[model samples]
Target chain A: MKNRIESKSEVDVSLKDLCKRFGDFTAVSDLTLEVHKGEFLTFLGPSGSGKTTTLRMIGGFETPTAGEVYIQGELANDKPPNKRATRTVFQDLALFPHMAVGGNIEYGLSFQGLNKKERKTKALKALELVDLEGLYERKVATLSGGQKQRVALARALVTEPPILLLDEPLGALDEKLRERMQGELKNLHKRLGITFIAVTHNQEEALTMSDRIAIIDRGRLEQVATARELYESPKSEFVADFIGVANIIRGKIIEDNAGVKKLLSDGLEFFIPSKEGFNIGDNAILVVRPERIEIGDKARKSNNSFSVRVRNIFYKGAYLEYYTVLESSQEIRIRVESKSSSQDTSADYKTTIGWNESDSVVLTREPK
Target chain B: MGRVTVPKRVSLWAFTILALMFIFLPSAYLLLISFEPSELEKVPRNFSDFSLRWYIQLFHQERLPGAIRQSVMVGLLTAGITSFLSLLSGMSYRRLRKKSYFLGLLIFPMFVPGIIAALSLSVFFRLISIRSSMYTVVLGHVLYALPYASIVTLVSFSGLKEGLIEAARDLGASGFRAFKDIIFPLTRGGIFGAALFGFLLSLNEFIRAYFLSGWQETLSIYMFGQMKGGADPSIYALAGLILSVSIFLVLVALIYYSFIRYFSRSFA
Candidate 1:
């Protein structure tokens, strides 16, 4: 997945060790991030992972308990939302139900001292920008879901803020509508060239629409990188499990001067081509992506190979995923993908599952 | 979705009619007794002599008329004050960290006995040198109506999405501006309902009004005076008038609200 336009050179928003605590519970802790100008950055995580808390702090809804937030190189920690140069599209769209579509678009301009005529003219222009030019007098309750989304976008954009914060803006829409809106949002971001920082728990949405994704878990930053980098080179077991489906197998590293082997609990040796910062007798976890594993006897194509018993098979439309376990133990899961064109004979039998060292990540685990 | 047994449908209709009759029976009885033609009977037997003879006398009486006027004024003032207080309470309720505790604390006066509240308010008014008059009666009525208003407003606030306010602030509106433009308009229905409830409660209230109103006589006080002076034909006429006016006002408000809603939707 690729963003429509390249992120500009300017740093639009920066956080320096930001922390937010509600009494004894810390919602976001010591988060430092820099969002480039005209970039669409997503904060992706599961519920209660502090992704929303981080976005709310950026939007000035929740003040940081410590540290600071800078927007375009200016301190904005205490600035009220009205004084900030940013806007947000809420999850429910939050269009004023009593107001017409034009009224909603023109709401933010009144505080800027714009005359009514100028406001109306700007509102019309914004509606045109969002492709809702003729819906000035239509009440919000009468609009369709997508139209309401467009109205929300127009409302946020009408103020001409430099950055937009979207807190799960497409969470309420149906799947087909959400996908269409995602495309529209990408195109809108490209056409406007404004920074967009969205917070969502859906990994697919984050991967499909962002220049970079910051994965947060348990009020801490796990990893912040491009979607491909985060998926392929996750630094921790938490990141690997949260980003996508990963089979995390615990083992002990054994070095014999020639090479290193990850000794699995089932007495299988994973021949590691190379690894960093691991000594002999050190516990580690190997994360192999399901799509990267080969489910055949082609051990020459893979750096590390082993055999396991097939436990179950799930038939997805595009591929078949096999869940295999070690012969002596049921702890490790060997997930391998079988495409529709290839016949899979690994079910109900012992089969070899292998992946090259380049296709897996060896992460440090807490020793028992 | 369409499969409904006949017995369930019958039971639902039966329950609805039963509820309606339960609500309307007392009011029908009051209206019928008001047309008793100055008779001493508790129940009206003859429908032939239902007349306005006592109604003319009721209006001609000076004290009763003045009392009704005073009650109306006090009721209106109580409604206004109660609505404003309820608005503040409801907003605070939305903002409070412990909402349930704050809500329970706010409606604490409602749980106490009516006489106890009246006695405590009377003592407090005297200690503050606020003489017992129509203003004090208004104060007491407002206190009596506060819980109803607060409850209604809180319910309305619960129905509203908090995101609207955050969205408004994000759109560059100040806190006051956001509430003035978005929150107030959206919650007006609940406020209106609370105000009506306050007005009706104040109008019917007798215990607190009797104690707090020194020389200023409200409708209930005047009715008590007439009853003490023996059976008065004018009292029935006045009760009938109050009932009719209340019903008419309620009907007018409903019709007017529906009309406004219809037109507002039409414009959209």
Candidate 2:
């Protein structure tokens, strides 16, 4: 029976307690995620982190060992990939090499039994949607790496599937081309407004393009939030470390009053809102972003401050990285704006570095 | 870079000529002897004494034409069956998790000597009370060709990117449709190679045909019978004819492979 797709709903793709195992190896474990309609959701993680596995489950290319994948409110765990209203732009851009650009894009339409003229028009429209108007007859072999990527995208999108799955689509392109394609893809996502679920190891790409980023590690999801939320208030140490440069300070809760806890790490003490299921005298881990810390005169204004010896200064064009070690020998990195340095903050000596207590987060357990 | 010396160029040309001559000499000798009035055990030494006597005798020979037709039929059937089976199994071969051990098992036939396999198969057929014919010979050749065909097909798959078939299915093609549209087109060259390999191997195979081809005479079996007493000069002519065709097939396969490699290189 034909699965006539219903109207768009609030949630386009819903993965519930999904798990996948290949013999003894668990590729995805108890991963539950909900993707809203028309929002670009990215599963961002390191390789072998189950991000791609989750994407494949959504596309129906993989069957979950446990739990369900729902597309448009219908359970799709048993449905074949072709039966699901999803298309994937694979990492290698698996365009049919023997076919022309038009043929590649028109492949799905052919399966739908569209007539020749209709298929051609639809193929052209899809190509144009990806900004490659005309040149329909160009062989895939002749297309540039970026062009092939666009063709793969167009081909996947031609059928107008409500959700588009991408497995590192810009991975094949060089640095400059990859940057350019990132912008193009973001624009395409905006113009199409489909629920695009993309898997990528690139944190920058996820932050730049995704409406929400799900940080996954070791086959389990660490956290799912907007890019800003993920960067500023990561729930787990893995999410903090994976998304950007994070300095995790191992400490203990010295005291607690109401919901606030006083944390004492090696040669440093600070106050952070107490996490649940933890009390005074319990071990506390503090996560601090490198960019959140201030050095020099500004350090005196913050609630949390420490004296640190400057170990190294890395001069980036936009920002400078200060690698410093506290008297406790706790090494931490601090990022400073290159444009705002009125005086040399690069002295190879002791300096005070600090951030507001609210900027740092205290967790009860160490990361796995 | 230093210029190539005259001696080096000459030596290279000389080596190439010698290699070519060494390879083609036996076939050339057979061809010359077939046209000459040569003895049963001797090759014609003088080109001046060459004639078309062997060719005429070859045409008048009994059961030889039937044997040639049988061999051709068996070759085509075996090649088609072998390639189809290999392509079918080769698809699953890619998805195998324990690929190394399974691949070793798949290629087990190539490890055993052909005579041993033939003998075992013939005995097994006898135990099963199955009569041998051209079909039996075809089956024997299929066993022999399967390993080579699968190897060629699996190599083609290695050159392809992972998840292509999955991508095809993800793009709204069914499993069968994915194979038809994506997998088959991508690996057609390898399938063709398998077919050629199967046909050539079956065409020239003797021990298997000798033991298994009951009530039917394949070309090799017919030739072996002729050589039971003392072989005719006409037999050399037939052998020369078969050798020439096999050579032509080898040339065609070489060109086909080179073309595929060249196109793939350019595409990459």
Candidate 3:
């Protein structure tokens, strides 16, 4: 009870030991997190990873089978969606097709005891805030995909909800439009300093638009941190692989000297950063990013360097990727910016590859 | 759209004209005979003999106008009740797990023969000590029209995307408010369409009205009685009037269907 009171005072929303099960299938399990007062937080996961289910639970659309949900420090497990202080922009945009843009935006205002004139005034204001000032009278069907997305945002905003929940809000837009809206959404969050809880499967969108991102996998909270922290220091192999391109090297820690550790795999030796509780003979996983592995003359200066045969090269417009393999048949990918002068102008050449000790992240294998 | 050969286009036009003529020929014959001036002649002897003599006499009959009024009253009541009930059933159909089973049960009455249904309803009302009246006639008509009404309303509800009601609720609208602001307006076209179907079905119904009518006969019953008693020129005039009214209503329904189609998809 004391902890509950403390959480209510500090957190805008709290989920404690929350679990949701559909028959034998557990959609969410014992998940707990706190959303701060005014921050952009994203729940990022793969499809069917329970991110949307968690968002629905927060918005009062789904009741948890066990545990509790608190909004502004008050227990809200029994509250209906309309009684909660959260509004959601659905995945499909679910704008009322029968109503004009103004009518859709003004729908929530009517419930707040605002008269017809006041509702119109507030709806027009919301439309302008979304950069659609003159589209209030326009029919929803006449709007383009991006315009419809803005109308959906304006509709949810007009209610002045403290917590705005977006379920893949830009999932329907084209790629370029999606990126543009991502920027617009970030701006809106800054301008209106309200809690924004968005759910998405797109890792890039989550990284670009969120103050903090919570990584969920198979109904479990894997990690929650800022984008930089999550990318630079992923705690698990799943996080490293899911967030971006990672070259995971699995081996046993065979040597620990000073603050550096030596890992041995397939008769090859690699150096990694050491942490507490990592002793000799314990198996570990190392996550080395592609761009971090330097080739050519720069490889000779690194602590852990190896010779590899270039297998293939892919020109990726912005960067060039070289697929190389070591003598032990282990594959490695190296990303070099397109403007770099590291191009050898030929394939099937032997080249040395290396990364600094600190750049390789070591993950201690969990006990079975 | 591939380009059609000239012969194919001509044949398509010919088939369309033939279908239209097949549908309207009987109504045209009724209109022509109603103006025959000779009481015994079924068709007008000459275009010059066309007159409004039977039409003037048709309205003077004591019971015909009253019968038409009662039939309209019954039709309105049936349409209102069937549409309201169908709305409830249609909305519930969305929430049901076994949708096909529920719909099958709702539409099961369509298979029952009309004479059998009318006789059973009359017997059941008598067993319950209920007298024949317009309300009873409405009850029978609602039973007959509900299957079609529910289908129409269900189709309308299908066009409504999922999560709309939930979105409205998330935005602070209560359950009732969501229905008023979202559900009703989006699907009102279907509801109105269901009501029109019920009105037409009830107006043309003869078997149930014959068994369940009160002191005042319905228009169908009166027309049936007049046909059996004598083949009068005034009866032909009455048939022409009924045909014209039915055609007008059908035209209105067609216009409404096109209007809603345009209104809903103009932006798309």
Candidate 4:
């Protein structure tokens, strides 16, 4: 099952045909992905989707039941974590409770054969790198949650491994703190310019931090693309639905003419831009992003317009959500930025909503 | 956090006092007689008659010193062996799939009656032609104490997050190095608790010591023998000393445990 490629310096880590089975349950199955050097790649999936197991296989914490892991072009399937050129900031942070901040950071240096004084100097430098300059002697139990997270990062970074694996790195923080750490981590990744493969179930965190997002579902790799590409042009219904809020309209394509395709479902019709591999009379799926749909007066002038009954309007802080239903009784949620004071649609029960043909993508139905 | 009602508070205080008296009254009587100069007198005749005469007489007993030495040796050996084995057992439990079954097997000895266990061990030793001694006493005590020690160690092991070991290994520590630097230091409280359990169990052991000890008697066995052959005031003094030492050790252990707990809880 080993899918080896010619050694390339640009790729830092590669997994091919990776499968892990615990008894009758398969956690990760025949998964393959290539992580480029100096890129921030995230394994994004829902819980129990085998995202963490895939990360563990890359980090050498778990051996794939069948497949090959290559680190820096060398086969790493049998290599223990310590022997691999990778370090992980575990989900719990896993800071050594018995050691002080300096000692925790200095732990990896002990194996490097550095003298105690040199190790202290390097550990202090690493501490300063994480903005905890003077708290070298502080015990882990005395540090706050955010400080402990930074200490975990600093400890893993002190070893200077070529690849850093973060398993839900900010999963333990509060909402406000998590958002702040996301920015800090992105900046840290930029400054270090090393391969950072993070595993997270947070779609927003993945969207904000990752250079490339690999969406995994039920142990299979659904899609791997940039955040913008995944959001705008998802190849599968699963990728489109999992990456963000999407109104997935399932129907059979009835009209294929010029550069547009018309899909009919029940009593309604939808016009979307023609896409490859979708033929007339084929059951295809259409993915329209919530933010891409236009409502009220502006929607009437778009390529595909519909008059829908507005069920409700939700006032989110930065935007407004219009929960509308079409003639066929399908629910559609439209998100419109509330930058102006006149973006209200509460007075009218019937509203027009439409999206440009290019705003929605056509994806083949995922096999049941 | 709820306020206690008057009747409930009063009853609680009364129950506490009664429990304390139930536990300490007999020991208090022995402690009072430990200060008397004469063996026949139950208490000091007067406050001015109180003396350390019996305590001094304790050292003069020929077998008492040897018995104490033998007991201490047995306690130290039992504590060391039990703690080490229990720690290893606790570590293995994490990797075991059928954990409850394995735990039940390890705890089976604790369910056996002490007298029956001691008699069987004594018979087994004789059948093997192994003479009963302090070493045999230690073996029996370890068998009795290991279940308790392992339970304590398992409790501590449970507190250890699996991520810590994985993080250590990710940071380039070998398995042995990870255990030395992380696992042992973090779970030392449970290991120490196990050791204390082994030491105390071996010290207070009577039935197994009575069955396994040959020629030289343990302190408990020696004390029992003295009670049967005209009780000595020195035995009361020894009882008072053992009680005080045990209380001091327990107090020290409690303080140390709380200190570790406090340190661990600040961030948790």
Candidate 5:
């Protein structure tokens, strides 16, 4: 009987309480995640945060010490890499230097027992998909970094696996090439409609390419949400700190009125509207993004306001960034459009920073 | 405006001439004597009419031809066996680093002096009631060549880029398929070099052949006997032949090295 997982809409790849241990060290711990069909899910975290390990487990390069992995709804914990219907583009792009571009892409087709002519046709088509149609006879070692990356992609895609795993495939390219490849990869995913699980530590890359980003930390799953949800409303201080630059002010919750909570710092108060599960007298942190901290002499009435002395100013071409030290001794950074810095503010004077209560979030302090 | 100092060329020529004299003098002396027309008891104090009579006599001997044939057969067999076994063992060592200690034990016979190893093997064969012959001589030569072959192959295997294997497997190749398609082709240079070395080693081996041979005499053993029995001009002819063969082997090895260098440089 055919497995029902191949026909399901819920998940194409799923991990259940997965854990990997290398002797005394745990590389990944009790991780559970679901990758939906045709979704671009990214594992984003710092190095050694189990993001790569999780990706390897999904690709069948690693076997979890505990828990199960399901690929297309079939149990794949014991399956070898060759047996799985998943292909991985390694971080180094691992293109075979000994083979020509056509040879490398045609390799997997040979294992399928395709004849020479058929294999060549399929490989040419795959290369054409990456816009490298005429370079099939070129040696891989002679290609540029971006071309090598395209060859790697063509090699993996020629197998036509249901799920494609990319472990920082663009990490080796220069910034401009990386950006271009990122767009090309995203477009390829849309055109092919294959499930793509990419692992990267670059937060911007994750935010730009992923349908959902799973932020991991120190071998544990921190949060998995859409890019906007992770950026605008982070559940933990780690997620907020990891996704984007945010100034975290630690304070004690002084009062809770209905759902809004008022937090007291050293000499100031911050009001956050409707923080779930936060009680009065609880030690919490208020996370405010740098872009949200409004700076000007005009005292616009707002819920959270503080007087800060500008310590330094950075004039970027598009935006002006000001680093200020608040009276409470807390440092805050604010950014405004370069054209918005009027001549009056150009005199480099002290300023008042303000934001609405809903602009900030009260995040629980992570365990030490 | 700037100081100019040329490197001293005196010591360079001194070392070059000294090295050439040290390497070529003995071989040249043998070549000169091999062309001398003289009797067994007479040693030429001065130049005499050069002749090829000794070489002709050396080649016309009945036993010498059989001994040469036996030596060539033994060398070929030793090279084939040593090269095949070393390739397998070396590849295993490369793949399984944890098992290197076991491989070291397998090749430990290489550290023993050839004479001692030949002696030990002789005693072992006698205890097992196995008689010594050309087969035993080939076995002894293989023991001496195996370790050298293994070391050469291991160095070549270590130089390979690990990404090639990973890429092969990622492209749906089984372990065996990857080894055959990628690993073996990339290592052909090392294999050929090792085979040449093993052939030379077996061809020139003297002590091991001396102890292991029974009815048949290897070329080296026969040459040793001829040298000790009497000082003949024909002995000089035989010595010249051996030296020429050694030079020919060296030239072959140089050719192999050049091929490998060209292959790697062109592809790299």
Candidate 6:
């Protein structure tokens, strides 16, 4: 899939070791990434982790202290935002509070020297693209949160820039509106086929919308890959923890057998396929998702099994989350389907938790 | 939940009485004396019949019309010069990091007492051999009003969100164009309010006019001179007219501002 996307188009923008510093603090450090033509790439990170700063540099709002930026394969480090063929939808929307919807959308076109009739036609078309037709003369302040977001999108798209930058555009909306707008934005991206670079901290949002996700941490790019690849095979412990919830069990590699590796924890042994390269006596951790751990009479036949006392049970609508303490004194959380007939029998009998060898992954223990 | 007890509305009534007494008593006294039969007394003994004699005398008094004309001219000149200079200074102070200390120094004159400022300017004018006139009074008033205008504009400029300007630039506007379209319109309210305040301050100024106007007297100076000659009732009538004019101008400004605000909001 990656090769197919790469073969379809060339790169649109490239950042070469981009670095931004403020006094003694480094905001973005030696970052390099490429945004391909007509692809939706998201920079996923926590606040102050340099995602917004990187976007600002690409948008020409902040100059990189070091390195270069290339737009359409040309060096564009010194170019102002007006010269760059990119428009940004700010986090706050930043719609002109004194202008009507049409006026706001037409402002950029007028700067492009378009005639009044031409600008109005383009603005109405752009508004229609965002499903906000006939809202041209409505006051922006009177619009709801989702409507404001659509107007912001129309304002940016009316300029017909090659790239659209969105800085958490749906962050201010409620959950339901955010979900709906996400679908709308994805559909819009598909229809326009323009390079869309978005910045967000929500893991689900990034996984759901982005064609490729770049996870950043502490001013450094940790990993960049497809959403499924990132979630299924995280490159580092930070990526694993950030992408989703997982039970991380500290252990050391005891043996490497053909393609299977055996790891030893406090008093238990586990097996996993050695795909990430592990040797004997190597310190490792076993990352297991809660849904992958089975709790039933069928647990005895699994490759890795352990006895644990059920500590707590939380009832989710679709699944039951069970917090259990293993014999090794480490607490592990497991999720089982809510339809299971097993009652809270921990008071009478001990429970065994198990998972297949293929479901466990050996990860390097991250340094504190 | 326990019942929530609403607080008593004691301060509201107290403030109402205080506001009325503070704002209305002096004007009421002035109006009462302006209709007095005896022109030399401060208090009026009776109000059997109202007459416009004092108002007639006020308009026809010798030198009063000229004083009013000079005051208006000086006030206009002072407001125009002060607002323009302060706007430039304020914009510079807001945009340039190196001008903060300089702005602080420029604002020092506003904190000085009016009497001291007038005295200092008088000494400086004498050294330069510049005779005092309506222009001199205007210069003194400008010195008094410029700092207020600068402060107001500076606050307005600072309150503006930097992202709005960046958004304009990102939309293909040059730096100057962005400032013209975004910054100027957003700060227009502050500019107008500051200019009106400066005009009012200059019109009602007395100390600077007293020291700077060698022969030609402003309205405030003329009124002060009349106050020393047994409190003429015609002067009270003149004061009442000036107060009414100030109130009318303020009301007009308020109405104009509300109209603009409503239009902007409706179309936003």
Per-residue alpha-carbon lDDT of model 2 for B10-107, expressed as tens digits?
Answer: 99999999999999887787776676675654555676766677777888988988999999999999999999988977778787888888789889
Comparison by TM-score, 3 against 5, better one:
3
Q: Which stretches of candidate 1 lie over 4 Å from their true place?
A: A1-9, A257-265, A311-314, A326-346, A366-368, B1-26, B36-48, B256-268
Sorting all predicted structures by DockQ, with the top scorer first, yields: 4, 2, 3, 1, 6, 5
**What are the chain B TM-scores of all models?**
0.86, 0.86, 0.92, 0.93, 0.86, 0.85
User: What order do you get sorting by TM-score, best first?
Assistant: 4, 2, 3, 1, 5, 6
Q: Who wins the DockQ comparison?
A: 4
List iRMS (one decimal) for every candidate: 3.3, 2.1, 2.0, 1.8, 2.5, 2.4
Model 6 chain B weakest 10-residue run by lDDT: B3-12
- Candidate 1 chain A has its poorest 10 consecutive residues by lDDT at A1-10
Which tens-of-lDDT digit does each residue in A2-112 have in candidate 6?
112233338888999999998899999999999999899999999999999999999999999999998777677888998887899999888887788998899899887
Ranked by DockQ, the better of candidates 2 and 3 is: 2
Residues B1-268 of candidate 6: C-alpha lDDT, one tens digit per residue: 6654444356667788999999999888887777776655465665665667799888678989889998899988888888778777766776576676877888999789989999999999999999998888889998999888788777767767778888889898899988788778877776776787778888999999999997889999899989897676788889888888888888988998888788777322
lDDT (Cα, tens digit) per residue for candidate 1, span B125-152:
9998999999999999998999988898
DockQ, per-model, please?
Answer: 0.52, 0.60, 0.55, 0.64, 0.44, 0.46
Candidate 3: clashing pairs of residues = none
**What TM-scores do the predictions have?**
0.90, 0.92, 0.91, 0.94, 0.89, 0.88
Residue lDDT tens for model 5, A44-107: 9999999999988887778899999998888989876777778899998877656788988998
Better of 1 and 3 by DockQ: 3
Q: Candidate 4 chain A — worst ten consecutive residues by lDDT sum?
A: A1-10
Task: Give candidate 3's whole-model lDDT.
Answer: 0.90
Runs with alpha carbons beyond 4 Å of true place in candidate 4: A1-8, A256-261, B258-268
Candidate 2 residues A150-217, lDDT tens each? 99999999988888999998889898988888888889999988889899998888988889999888
Q: Which residue runs does candidate 3 get wrong by more than 4 Å?
A: A1-8, A23-25, A251-269, A276-284, A364-368, B257-268
Question: Chain A TM-scores, one per candidate?
Answer: 0.91, 0.94, 0.94, 0.95, 0.95, 0.92
RMSD of 5: 3.7
Task: Tell me which residue pairs clash in candidate 6.
Answer: A139-B268, A140-B268
Which model, 2 or 4, shows the larger DockQ?
A: 4
Q: Between prediction 2 and prediction 4, which has the larger TM-score?
A: 4
Per-model lDDT:
0.83, 0.85, 0.90, 0.90, 0.84, 0.85
